[model samples]
Target: MTTNQRRAARFNKAFGNRLAGPLLSRMPGFGAVLHKGRRSGRVYRTPVKIFRTAGGFTMSLPYGPKSDWVRNVQAAGGCQLVSLGRRFDLVEPRVYHDREQRVIPRPLRPLLARFKAFDFIELRLAPAGAGRAER
Candidate 1:
């Protein structure tokens, strides 16, 4: 991460996480990635800009991979996400640098581009129509 990225991360943790995180997490198109702490086992909800993809969903990592939520999800191999008024069990975690951010909604692309958040968290959502137990 560059100096700017580091600064932004700090600011987000200090303010954004506490203030905007909860509200955004509940809204449509924006939601929370829920993960457990690597050691403490405490659950955490992180606000993220999420977009639906062909098979699943992609999240913009504005704070890059070093963010706590990103690390937690990666370490655990899977996590739950609440978005679009539904709960999804997301698995097969992968990280990538989506330079063009093609997965993001067109209207939001420019805003995300300004933050240079090319890092993305990709996960495969459980098959639709699966029974509650399957999900």
Candidate 2:
């Protein structure tokens, strides 16, 4: 990672769980969580903006395809989403293909464009009540 990338990662690691967690919960369209990679088993808890869609709650992987969290969610087939003091298990997350990219909402276009260097993934969560129990 570049120096700035490393620094950002460090900042995220430190403040993400402690400060970002509660802050994200207060945001109208955001959620935060720690997710474990099914294969590598590494875990990352970070902040994400979520929107209610026809299928379910959708969040964009703006950091792009190489992001460890994105890969982990893909491998694990789901992830843990925490918001407003509640946690839910997200399932069936899939990367956004070329055609699907055109449909990304305009409000999120800027955020998604920032990660243009990396491929984006759109994650859809399972129903609230159907989430797996927290460990």
Per-model C-alpha RMSD: 2.8, 4.3
1-135 in candidate 1: lDDT tens per residue? 789888878888688878998788678888878899998999987778888887778899887887888889999987888765677888778999988887887888889888888889998876556422122
Off by over 4 Å in 1: 127-135
What is the lDDT, from 0 to 100, of the residue 124 in candidate 1? 85
**lDDT of candidate 2 over 1-135, digit per residue (tens):** 356655675676677547766788667777775788667676767787676666655665544455667677777788877766667777788676453455567766666666542244555657667765343
Backbone clashes under 3 angstroms, per model: 0, 0
Candidate No. with top TM-score: 1
lDDT of each: 0.82, 0.65
Look at candidate 1 and tell me the lDDT of residue 65: 81
| Residues forming the 10-long window of minimal summed lDDT in candidate 2 | 115-124
CA shift at 27, candidate 2, in angstroms?
A: 1.5
